[model samples]
Target: MHFSIPETEVRSDENGSTYVAYNIHVNGVLHCRVRYSQLLGLHEQILSDLYTFFVYEVRKVTKLFYFLPVVRQDPILGSSEMFNSFLRKAQQETQQIPTEEVQLEIYLFSGQKVKVNILTSDQTEDVLEAVASKLDLPDELVGYFSLFLVQERGDGGCTYVRKLQEFELPYVSITSLHSPNYRIVLRKSYWDTAYDSDVMDDRVGLNLLYAQTVSDIERGWILVNKEQHRQLKSLQEKGSKKEFIRLAQTLKYYGYIKFDPCITDFPEKGCHVIVGAGNNELNFHVKLPSDQMKEGSFKVTRMRCWRVTSSVPVANGTANPSSSSKCDVKLELAFEYLMSKDRLQWVTITSPQAIMMSICLQSMVDELMVKKSGGSIKKKKRLNGSFQRSDSQQAVKSPPLLVGAEVFTKLSSVSLRGLSSSNSASDISGNDFHGNYAFEGIGDDDL
Candidate 1:
């Protein structure tokens, strides 16, 4: 069967043979090939070969992703023993690189990895001594100098630096340090950690979080007032112990600060902050029980933040017990509230808030996939005798390789993600059929 494609020019050879070569992008990936044959009559052979090459290119691209993030985050994996084992197993499974040849290829590719060379400067001994004394100097920070360090080859030749006795050259500027001279050519991402040319696929949510910041939120909120405190004091004065507790809870819920009840008999829930932590402030853990708790006790359950009147419904439609609302809600509410008001505890996000922005991107991708698969709500029309109820069933009837491409790409990408870093969870969650989030973290750490 023929696939629809743009018109292209083709010319016949002297022997009456014809050839045409061009590029087609599938799922944000590309492949290039030129073909020649006696007669190209919807040639099934070409389709098969094209699919083969398509899969290979996809594997290579995905391999870059799988290996890249791992190397970046986990230093253990970057060690020679582990890296060499990885090469051995990968070559065996894919046969893309022969096991015997993997070392040479990896070395050849070493040039692309961040490199640094520390050449012997005048009176290099002191510099070498200082560098040697510096703990955990990664070759990426000082690899180019690896050459300068060695008087002879031991095991990995010039590429391996673990055996070096000292930093090869002192006075060579470390490209990474604030201003230390150690001539380091490390991957910019290793130091930069913010942007990567390889990671733009994740551009969506980051754009929004960057656009919105703390200052924007502060403008919208009104702080807790004296009247509310006055009302609370009236309850306390009347000896309405329960009423005072309830109001205290209300104030806390609204983001007003609350000290733990000082009564010795009360079972602790959370330690009281000896010093009040600022709104959304990342409070440090004291060696002692929190001031919020009894002198030696901890809170059994954290008191809800007084500031959040609302929270977003979860993706699965479950409401957080801490939130007042039960309905599925937009996450933007929490963000907006935090930005607008003061006096509620600070939001403790481990990473940049830009991640939430990517959700809209995910939705957009899902929509595009639905469109690409042919609009919502399929009109029930049958052609010939080959109708099927699901794409999975339809896939059963397509050519084996064509149907398998989905699996091939997924199998290659998932294992890397599932096993990698703290980011493994995000990798799996963000990877959808449209390939929108595939390589985003490959280049940068949101952390």
Candidate 2:
């Protein structure tokens, strides 16, 4: 709920009118952009509203009213400092607001939805547990499920999907963004499916895939030689849905970049680079016909910056020489090592690889930043990179909230029942709950 008025930048429109654009960051995340005119209008609105509220009091023949200036005679309210001061006051007022219940629409992967009321200040874990109970998930099976906030963008637009991590911010605040189109989806088998399968089938032939020696298959790196490429193509031709799903479900934090160190300099040699993340470090290795070995890598904590550059197609040997407009964009990723700030280590990767690497690096950096800031790391306890399942029983005996039922009706029923029982203290606010039930566009909704 924090707000900040950061530095403004000069921007121009198509009509050539330039204005100062303010960057409004909320809790370190970019919320929205506002122009100088918007700030002026905001100040005017605040002044008008406040003046209207105090007009009658100011008109009294009281000593306090004598010192009050008329609206027309008041000091200017549309300055940068005035706008900032108003924002600061507003931020302080927002913190004083009491925590209230917020209704969240929980969407299931099977396209069904159930509504649940949760407090705004409730932690994400509490919301998840409530969701799990609503979904009829047993204690043992609940570990496989995870919640994701889905922002459904307009048709053909990009949809943003964010996994609700255990240590994430409160559930209510995250849903407030794009509220109309936002939904909390319950995804089953949400953990790393590939790793889970590998663990379960460790005694099988897949063991070769995770072998330690260079001659054997490496766990994280993908072998992209001609033989494997042919094998993948053959598997594709066979078109077995199970096999395809197995291949596609093999997840990697850092995507495999196939590159050959010896022939990587000569683009015509068809080299590739394979990369992986291990123990807070980025592992870059080269896969060759005869031998596979580590090329080079650096700990993510040691990186200060990541710079990317694009090159002309002609310079890259992979591009077709005859067609000038051919798809031949070669991307270069450069890392500024903290220990050696004077020089940067760079690598050539395709556009897709560059994007994947950037995403992985950014995620790692964000986590490292959190750790450096001394935020508690509440990672799920794991044995060999896998979570250990808990065997405790779930408290709920029956479905807490019935699906396809009106939320208010169910809540009212429970509150009334609890009032008659000995558990009256555990019920929601007796008469206040019904009065405070505020639903946005709830009339047309069936539940």
Best model per lDDT: 2
Q: What is the C-alpha lDDT of each candidate?
A: 0.23, 0.38
After aligning candidate 2 to the native by TM-score, how far in Å is the CA of 322 from where it should be?
A: 54
What digit string (tens of lDDT, one per residue) describes model 1 on residues 273-304? 22112221212222224433212111101111
List ranges where model 1 is wrong by over 4 Å: 1-66, 71-77, 81-447
* Residue range 222-335, candidate 2, lDDT tens digits: 444566546555765784434533543443332232222222321123345454544344555444444544355555544444433333244344422123132333444444
Could you tell me the TM-score of candidate 2? 0.33
TM-scores of the candidates in the order shown:
0.16, 0.33
Off by over 4 Å in 2: 1-98, 138-147, 161-171, 186-194, 198-247, 250-447
lDDT of 1: 0.23
